[model samples]
Each structure stands twice: as structure tokens, then as C-alpha cells.
Target chain A: MTMLEVLDVSGLVTFQDSGRRGWQSYGVPLSGPMDWFAHRAANSMLNNSTDAVVIEIGLGEAMFRAKRDCVLAVTGTGFEVVNYIWTFPLWTSFYVRAGWRVQVKKISGGNWAYLGVAGGFEAQSMLGSKSTYLRGGLGSAIRAGDILEAGKPARELAKLTARNFPVEKFMNYSQSPVIEVIAGPQQDRFTEEGVQTFYGSEYTLSKSFDRMGYRLELLPSPSSAKGIAQATSADLLSEGMTLGSIQVPDNGQPIVMMADSPATGGYPKIANVIRADLPLLAQCEAGVSKIQFREIMLEEAQENFQKLNKAFKTPKG
Target chain B: MLKPLGDSALLVQLGDEINPALNQRVHALNALLQNPIHGILETVPAYSTLLIHYDPLTLTFDQAAHWVRDKMTQLDDSFHRTPRRLEVPVRYGNASGPDLETVAVSKGISPADVIRIHSEREYTVYMMGFTPGFPYMGTLDERLIMPRIATPRTLVKAGTVAIAASQTGIYPLDSPGGWHLIGWTPLKLFDPTSETPFLFSPGDVVKFIPLESLESNSLLFDQ
Candidate 1:
């Protein structure tokens, strides 16, 4: 069995897979990579299955030594991979010979980055997931002196030249960054002015953002609604929450729930980020990233979703 | 009452307000849905609503909504029968409960009186959320109602007993919290290593016993 020794790890580094599903019934939030598209892309680059465990690096540097020759790729924002002491940016694939040391440097832009080994890193699974939930003390983030096992029996790599995968034709932060949305069940609960403001005005990404939710600072709205508030007074019953659900609590500010959000919340959701644009939201950088919402038909949303999935399924040569 | 929550989920609401009967109904439906039901991916119980999450691939939104309605209609006298009662022990009014005096003053009652009233009444476990193992028990004695602090403390130690909005509960982990601390409990409400991670499930009844009683009898707190 091949293993990688962690020479250094950042404070926020952890192991993430597609996430532990079917456990929300026990009050566990779905803990996984904040950016699913990047996670899958990193896995795909190595020809690993979509759900293979990958290292989720955040805001710090990790130095490791490969015990075996393996193909690897880095995806998501910020951070760069230094192989043989050379820096490679996001979405590129490379091969590292056995015994070569690789270092992931501090994030330069985004909050998270993913490093996927050709044969996925193996770790103890809890509740059928390799992902770590820091809040619950399930799995700790990767640390120095920690050893990680690689998945399964290794196979010989076919003699092949490294090639760049063409960027897919889909929405990302770098592309048409607007997020499409649908009118929510509680959209009517907001004052008519609030609704107009929501669509017409732009919001900046607040500094306070994480896997739980993203708080968007509301711009001064000329048509701001005065007192349109959440209808249900009681704390909402716990229920299935998902990525892109826009929750508005009593404070009048809206929070876009992300992957790790609880199964339920008391805040009334004003809209859901269209499925196609959720990936874009995942890749967005903090700061004054302008946000505007446009309503689209459910059928159109589904079509866009299918298109994105199809692009993801297409193999890169 | 039920409403369309979204294309993929439906909200089966009991009422606009939190009522014990409604909470029990939500829990009953949750238990009923747990046995590998078709099309239902997840059923989550909240303070006043039960959100049924279904797979859009297996069942259409309308079909899932209809299924939930059908299940609710089939529920009868047997569903609302006696719930499991759990006795929890708490050590009140020390570092465990930093806000005990504050809460007592806010309610115009003595700290000792607050403890007596809180311990005497049995509360319902309305839902489990806000954090893992954080039980949202409700129907607290009206005398204990207190507003959440205007400025929420950034950190509240785990097992810190707290009260807010006519409800009483325990913090499962040390996280940023706002609930008024009344006391602390030594029992671990949520341990991921345990076969059953959650100490209290929805529809369960919870009674708080004084820590003095547990110490005197040398009795272990068991659910």
C-alpha cells in the first residue's frame, strides 16, 4: 500500500468526498467540499471516480512526499501546486514520480482548493463518508505527521503524454457569473418593494462567508420594503436544506445556504439559486462580488442543469 | 396545513405557532417515513413544519406531496400515543449557567425559583438542529420566557444549559451561541462515536432532574 506523509498542513485542510448523504435524519449536515464542481473535476483529472476522496486545502500550505508515482491534479480557486518546486495553477493535470515532494502553497484568491491523487487518498470512513466535519469532531483536518493511504491496488500507468483539458462551455465565476433563481415559496412574504430591490439592486459578498452559508451585504435599495418579515414566528422545523437555498432570517438580510447547511432552518427562503448557477456560486470570491438574480422557468433551469452535467461527464483528452 | 416548499420538497406545516400537539404530529410522521419509504429521500422535522425531501428523479413534486398527504391521512390514534420520556440532570447556577441570575432578574424571579419551575415541568423535544445533538425542546413554563440577548455571546461552552423564547435546551458543542445560559449538564448529548449519536429524538419527552439528586443517589443519568 502506498502512503503520503503530511509534512505540513494548514489550519483548515481536511478530507472531502461527495459527502455523507442519508444522514440528515440524525441532524448531521452534509459535510463535503464547498465546491462540488471543482471536487469532481479534480477527481476526473486523475481518472478517479467522481466520489473518490480528495484533499480540501484552505488558506495554507501543505508539504507532502509521494511514496509511489501517481498522477495528480489541483482544482478550485486560490492555491497553487508546487511540483518539483514549480507552481501549477488550477485545472491542470500533472504526474509526480515516486519520492518527489509536492507542496501546496497558501491560497492567493479563493477560500478552498482540492488536491486529487490518481488513486484517491484513503482514510477511515465515518457514517459512510471520508469527509471531515470539524464542528462535530468526526475527522480532524490533515496535520503534519499524519499518514494517508491511497485507494486500492495500484495499476501501471499507460504510456501517455500529459494533455490540457479544454475548458467546458458552462457558467463559472470567470464566465457569465450571474446566478439564475426561481421565485421562492416565501417570495410573497416580502414586501413588493423588497422583491423589486432584490432583483434590481446588487449585493456584495460579505466577509463573513463559509460552508454553512454566504451572507451578502445588501446595497441600499431605493425600493426597500419597510416591514415585510418572515411569516412563521417559531423557529422553523428542521428539514432538508440544500445548496443555493436563499434563507432570510428576521434581520432582513438574506443568507444563501451552502453544502454544509443544516437540514432545516427557521428563516424563510426567498429564492433558490438555479441549479446550473450553484457551481458558479461555489467558485465566487469574497469581496464586492456583485450579485443579481433573474427568474427562469423550471424547465429552462432543468435543461441548463442537464447541460452542465453533460459537460462534466465528457472526458477531457 | 401543507404548502409547496419548492420543486423538490414540500412543507407539511402543523401551525404558524409552536404547539406540543403539532410537534408530536410532526415527529409521528417523521418516524413513519423512516422505514425506507419510496421516493422520500429525507424527512426533516422543524419547530412547526415537517419538510419532506424527495428525489426528483424517482418522484415528481406533485406525487411526493400527494404521498405525504396520504400518509398524514392514514395516521390515527396509534400514532400520537405515549412518547418516550428522558430524564436529564443539570447542575444549576455556577459557571455552567452564567446567565442564571440575569435570566432570573429579567423574569422578575429568584434564581432558585427559576430552577424549581424549570425542573418541575416536563418539556417536549420539538426538534434537533442548530447544531448536532442540540435538541430544541419547547413548551417551557411561561414564567421562564426571556428574550435572546441583544448582543449574542460569541462562545457558549458545551453542556451550557440555556433558555430562550419560552423554550429550554442544552448546547451540544462549544460554538457561537445566543441562548441565555441557565445552567450546565455533564451529560454528553451528542457523541458521534456512539451507535445512536443523538440522545434525544423528536417526539421524546424530556425531564430535567437537579444535579444534587444525582449526586446524592449516585445514580447515572440515562435516557
Candidate 2:
């Protein structure tokens, strides 16, 4: 069996697939990679399927050593990585000599990164997901001294070696982008001014951002009299929540729910960041990542999401 | 009413409040749509709303809305199906129940009376959320209803029986909560290794049986 030994790890690192599906009724959360685009890119570089298992490296830094000759890809923001003696780059796959170390070093920009080895990481599947959901006690995080295993590569090691994925073809993380939203299910709970305050203002991604949700603090407008986005209703009845739900509590700071958010919540959701923009939002570094919101129709959101899926059909050079 | 939740899901509001009648309707609708409807990926039934998850490429929001509407027409609003009833054994009013005396005092009753009133009537499983298998059982006798403590405890232990507002809940895992602690159960509500991890589903029925003292049920852990 193909394998890699975890030599060192900092922060939280876990194996995630395309999330657990079809189990919300029993109160199970949909746990998966924080950044889907980067996770998939790491998989695509090695000709693996979109849902193939990959390592999600979160927070400070992590390091791993290949126990056997294999192929691997690294993607995501914030950290500079060192693959063996080479000054490595992100978004590309390369062959690994047995016993070489691929160290994820320096958090200069983002929070999470993906390391997709040849084939996929093999972990005990719980409820049909290889994803590690710490809250549910499902799968565990990868730790130092732990031996991680993977299935043999799908193709010849020679053919899978050195596959390059261009950064320009993907959602570029360099620019400060306008994340789009469709009005949330509980939009009626807020006044027109409340909706405006959400759409017309800049918000900073606060430190509370995680796989559960990205908490956004509304920046004060230039004119103080514009007013805050307070909900007309005091306490909302708890209801089912979707991925990317922008729930505003009493403080009026919007918390955009992510892949592992609870199935149900009580806060009045003003809007939902469209599915097409979740990956971009997920890649944003806490405190450092500044974002703005744009309201778009549901049809347009759906179209943009389809376009994104289509673009990932093949990464451009 | 059909509400849009991003590009992937639709929230179907069947009723306005958290009434049992409303919840039954939600569960009925939940049962109908759960049987492998084309494009409908999953149905999450809450207190008064049913959330439908779908594949965007196969079904648009409008298409899912239309399909749900079509399914609604066929649902029996008076739907009453036999539910799985579970009896949970709990040890009340000691170290297990930190707020048992306070709850009884607030209601002008003795701690034992509080236990009797709580264990008397069976409650309905309104929803399962906040954690795995933490059944949100409700309709506590109005006489027993008490406000949740002002400050939520940072960490409540697993299998703790707690009461807040009008619902009774069991802590399946160690989670931060605000409910008044009244007892604890040895039986695990979330047994991960079992084929059925959760002890209750959304539409199930549950009753709490008072235990005199702690009993060893160590087989329920470290699976």
C-alpha cells in the first residue's frame, strides 16, 4: 500500500472528501474541506475524481514525508511550501522520491491548504464520508507519529508525475473580490434598510471564521447616520439552514455558514453567499481577508455556479 | 411557502409556529419526499420547516419548488404513522443535576416533585441538532417550564438530562449548553459504532424513566 508518515504538524490537519451527503435528518453535519476549489484542484492535477480524499492543512504549519515513491499536489493560500530540496510552488503535481519531505511552511496569507497524494488518503469511512468532523467524533485529525495510508495511484507513476495546473485558470485569490449573495430564507424578518446595510457595506472576516462559518463584522460607514442592520424580529424560530447562509444575530454581524455548519439554527438569516462564491470566501484569511457583498438573483447565482463547475472540467495552462 | 436558500436548496415553510400539529405536517411532508425523489438529494425536517437539498445541475430551485408543490397535493395532512418510542433511564437531582434545587425553588416545589412532573408525560422528538443524537424533545408540562439560566455553562457532560423553556434534551456529547441540569442518563444517545448511531429520529417519541442511582453501563462507550 502507498503511504506517507506524518513527521510534524501544527494547527489542525484532517482528511476530507466532498463532504458527507444525505444524512442531515439524523442531525449529522456535512463535513468536508473548507476550500472546495483548492481541494479539487489538488485532486485534478493527479487525474483523481473531484470527491477523492485529500489532506486539509489548517492554521500555522505542517510537514509530511513520503514513505514510498509517489505523486502529490499542494494547493491553497497563505503558506509557502517546500517539496524536498526544490523551492516548490502551489497548484502543481510532482513525483516524490521515497523519504523526501513536503513541508508546508509559513502562513503569509490564507488559512487552509490541500495536499492530495496519488490516489486518495485512506481513512475509516463514517456514514459514507472520509471527512474528519471533530465535533461529531467521526474521523480524527492527522497527527505527528501517525502513519497515513492511501490507495495506489490510478495511472502509471511516470504518467502522473509533474502535472501542472495553472493558477490563472482558477479563482485567483490575489484580488479583493465582491462575494455575491441571494437573500436568505428569513429575509422577511429584516427591514429594507437592514438588507441595504448588508449589501451596501464592507465586512471584515473576523477571527471566528472556521469550517462551521465565517463570522463577518460590518465596517462602519463613512456617514454615521446611515444606521445599523438590526432585525425587525427579536428572536427567530430555529429552522433548517443551508450552506453559505448569512445569519445575523442580535449584534447584526453576519455569520456566513460554511460546509460543516449545523443543519438548523435560530438567527434570522439576512442573505446567503451564493454557492459559486463559497470557495473564494473559504480561501480568505481571517482578519487579513476583507470582502464585500453583492446581491444577485437566484438564476444568475445558479448560472455562475454551473460556469464554475464547467471551468473545472480542465484547468487551463 | 417556498423560500430560496442560495443556489442549491429551497426552504419549505409549512407552518408558522412550533406546534405539534405543525410539526406533524412537516414530518408528513418529510416522509413523502424522502423516498428517492428524482433530483431531491435530502430532506431535513425541523420544528416548523422542511429544508430540501437538491442537485443544482439536475433540478433548479423552481423545478424543486414545483415538484414539492406537486408532492404536497398528495400528502395526507392528517397523516398519523406509528412512531418509534424510546424509554430513556435517568438518575435525577444530585451531582448529575446541578440546577435541580434551583428549578424546584423557582417553581415553588420540591426536587422530587420536579422529577415526577418531568418523568410523567412522554415528549415528542421535535428535532435532532446542535450535536449528534441530541434529541430536542418538547411539550414539557407548563408547570415545569422554567427559563434557561442567564449564563450558559462552558461545558456540559455527555448523557446529561436538561430542561429549558418547554423542552427536555439529553446531551449526547460534551457540549456547551444553557439548559437547567436536572438529571443524567447512562444509556448513550449517540453510539457511534452501532449500526444506528442516533437513538431518536425527528418524528420519534421518547419518555424519561427516573433511576434511583448510578448503574454501570460501560459497554456504551469507547466503541
Candidate 3:
């Protein structure tokens, strides 16, 4: 089934899936959806395979026109969805009539939104994934006036009607989230006070944020302006870095490594935000979203991660 | 020390500095577990650490840590396998290398002396990072060591052979890089179509051979 012609794209829209895996050893980053839960949720609502390629839209407004009638689901945090003058709620499947226009506008509370067709968007898959890595010139790049083709939907538009998922059950983006984290590999490199401050202090997501990292700033305060101090000033021997790894460089603020973070880094990591709260951190509006960090034990973090996976589990009928 | 990284992977830290001994142990552990444990997914070996990605659903953090810790105890420290030796051909000076004169002038050496100093040493592929298939080779001759340029160029063409403090590397793909560009290589470091995409692997020994002219390997750039 072929549909969805891109009309206008003010934001960066690219095709993404579960990400390219098993290539990190060669210095390749696992480029995928910034909001892992939202991507899977959109696909599940349409009974699409969990690994289906969805369009990741970031930076604000975009417009798409359907070439033919198709079943579509849009999920993310606080994005307004409209077909003509009629608005539609997110996290639910909707039938788009042929030649109708769909407009997605960012109202507030998030930086990314996912558009998953029932059959999933067909895109250029390189190195075992359709996830777009623009820097590496790897996957599909969607621009204004491009034609998007998709595979056959498991069921026609009629069967996907009325299927809706409550986003609040999995994530509540409205509130300033108290994100959970675990100790990182270089946790010992931070001062005792630094560890305490990282967990206690409120941080604002800086504008210097991207798929590589989300640099966090110590929320301005009367006394705690120096930020998280370090035990050592030396950079660590460059080593493998993982997603959510919170590296506190010489400046003392933290940079949360994200989906497209390099395979390795040299900065001293203070702590790592748990996998469960990464989506929440990724969605935070840069410079606008206030964030807090709460340290959790490894077992607790494991349970939290599993809970998120369960919510995003696939093959829905 | 085996430490948990968030809830997805474990960081096996072998040492605190960049040394061949530490890199050997890193690659040793990687070789031992070429076929990963039941729940482990992939292993990424770096200068002094190895990151093992795992499935959180199948293996709990403790279970994965326990399995790797057992292997660490039995890790072979002795250098058993002979490293692979390969030569990378480079076109130095002139249009192929825009910064050759500046680099030579900065180091108070002729361009030929700089090339001779850079290509003589057989550097070890310490790790692959910065970009895909971009090897972080080390033991750069002290005479040629230069810190990265203050202002990085917006577009450093792919296959640009460059150097930074104590290291020499190739730009596998066109990227914005700050490294001091000393030469250019017709060889593609990253070939996604090949059986082995990356030209250099950790634990391999690489030597750079300067290309006096390109007529010898015109077919290389064709691919």
C-alpha cells in the first residue's frame, strides 16, 4: 500500500525503527527512535510489527497528504493532530481518507512525535535497520515533496478503528518527571558531594541537545552554582559508552548520552539515568522542561526497565 | 571491575589509562566471548574497557555480571595470537593533504620528514570510535604529535588521514572533525558492502604507506 505524500516539513522528519544493532563494536551508534515507548506504542495500535519503520518528527510542525485511504496512528507526548478542521487525539488509530491532509503541530511538553502506519513505512534499510543516521548517511531521509510507500497492512482500515492506547498509563508527560537513575561505571570519579548534588538538584535540559546527548544544566540557585564537582580532573581513558550514560565533563554539568551517542567517550561519567526514564528525558522540551533525578538500585532499575518493555510489547491484533 | 550501565549493559573496566597491556586484556576478553553468554547481545571493546550489551528481560544485572566476572578471572593475559598487519596507502601533500605544509611548519620539519616520521611506525588499532569503522590507532611519533585544530572544518571529506595528540586516525565518512589533516587516502576505511566493513579491528597492527601517485590504484577509488 502506497500513500502519504510529504507536503510541508518544518521539522526534521526521518524514518526510524528499533535501530541498527550489533555494530557498536565497529564504532557505529545505534540510531533509533528517541522516545522508545512512543514508537512501539504507535506500531502496536495498528497491529504492525514492533520493528516497523515509523516517521520520527521533531522541531515542530509537518503536513502529510494521503494518496489513498490508510490506517494511521500518531503517538508522542503533547502534539495536536488534525485532519482538515477536525482534530484527533493521539495514541489511537484513525482512518485517513484518500487526498485528505494530516497536520501535526507541537503544542508543548515534547520534542518528538511518531507516525506509524498500519503496515509501517517502507524505507531504506542499511546495516540491518531502517533507522535514519543522517551523519553517517545511512537510512531514509524524508524531505518536503517526497512520496512515502508502505507495506500491506495486516488488516484494512475498518479493523483498526476504535483501537486506542492511554498514553498516561505508560507515561505522563505533563508533569515534571522525577526520573530514576542508577550508578554509572565511573560513579566513583565524582566527589561525595557531587553524587548527592546530582540526585538532589533539579536540572534543565539545555538547548545543546540532540540524538548524541542531552546536556543538563544545574537549575540556577542561590548557593549551588558551582554544579557537580569531580574527584578527578583527568579525562578517563576513552571507553565504550552506553545510552543514558551521564558524563560530567570538566565544566561539572552532566551530558546524558542518547540514542546516537558515540560508541565510546573520554569524559568522567557521574551516573546513568535508568533505561525506564530515558524516554521521559528524551522528550523534555529543551530549555523549558524542568527535570529531577532520583537514584535507584540496579534491581529496581531492572524491574523498571522490564515494566516499560511490557507496556511496549508488540503484535497486537 | 564489572559495573552496570543503566539497565541495559555492563561496563568491564580493565584499567585507568591508555596502554597496550590494557588493550590486550580488552581484546582478550572479547576473543574469549566471541560467542556471547546466553543473555548477552553484543560486546564493544575499547582502549581500557569493554561494553557488553544484554537483554534486560532474559538476564538480570546480577546474573550478567556474575557470568562475565567468572570469565575475567580466567582471562589469558599472555599475548597468544599474532596481530594482523595491514598497510594503508595515503596520498600526502598538495591538494590531497591541505594542511601538510602548516603541520610541517608547526613541527619545524619538512613535509617529507613529516611523512617519513608518520608512516614509519607500525601503530596498533587501539579502538574504533568517533565514527563507524574509524580506527583510533596510537603510539604516534612524538615528533609529529599535534593537538587538534582549534576550529574544526565543517566538512572533512571521507578518507582524510589525520592526527591528534598521540594518535592518528582516518575519517571513515565525511564528518565535521577538528583533527589536524596531514594526508588523504584513496582507501575507504568503511565499506558497508564487504564481509568485514571496517578495515582495521582492535588488536590489529596497521602501517601507512605513502602514495607517490594515484595511477597505481585508480581502481580503488572507482569502488
What DockQ class does candidate 2 belong to?
Answer: medium
Candidate 1 C-alpha lDDT tens digits along B103-181: 8888899999999998998898887778887888888898998888888889988888899887888998898888898
In candidate 1, stretches whose alpha carbon ends up further than 4 angstroms from where it belongs are: A9-11, A78-80, A85-89, A105-110, A153-155, A159-167, A219-240, A311-317, B1-8, B37-39, B76-78, B220-223
Q: What is the TM-score of each candidate's chain B when compared with the real chain B?
A: 0.92, 0.92, 0.92
> What lDDT would each prediction earn against the true structure?
0.74, 0.83, 0.85
Clashes of each: 8, 3, 0
lDDT tens string, model 3, A1-317?
67899998876788999888989888889889998889989988888888999999887678999999998889987688999889988888899999999999888888899998889999876888889887777864688899999999988779986689877877777437888888787788888888888888888888888888899888987435778888888768888888889988888889999989998888887788887788899888877888998888989888877887787665456
Q: Is candidate 1 or candidate 2 better by TM-score?
A: 2
Q: Identify the candidate with maximal lDDT.
A: 3
**lDDT-better candidate, 1 vs 3:** 3
Clashing pairs in 2: A78-A109, A78-A110, A184-A271
User: Model 3: what TM-score?
Assistant: 0.95
Over A78-169, each residue of candidate 2 has an lDDT whose tens digit, in order, gives 87779767767887788888999889886666778899987888888888888999998998888998988888777887888777777666
Candidate 1 C-alpha lDDT tens digits along A5-82: 788886578999998776675577878888777788777766777789999886567888877777777877667788
In model 2, what is the error at residue A203, expressed in angstroms?
1.0
Q: Candidates' DockQ values?
A: 0.38, 0.74, 0.78
CAPRI-wise, candidate 1 is: acceptable
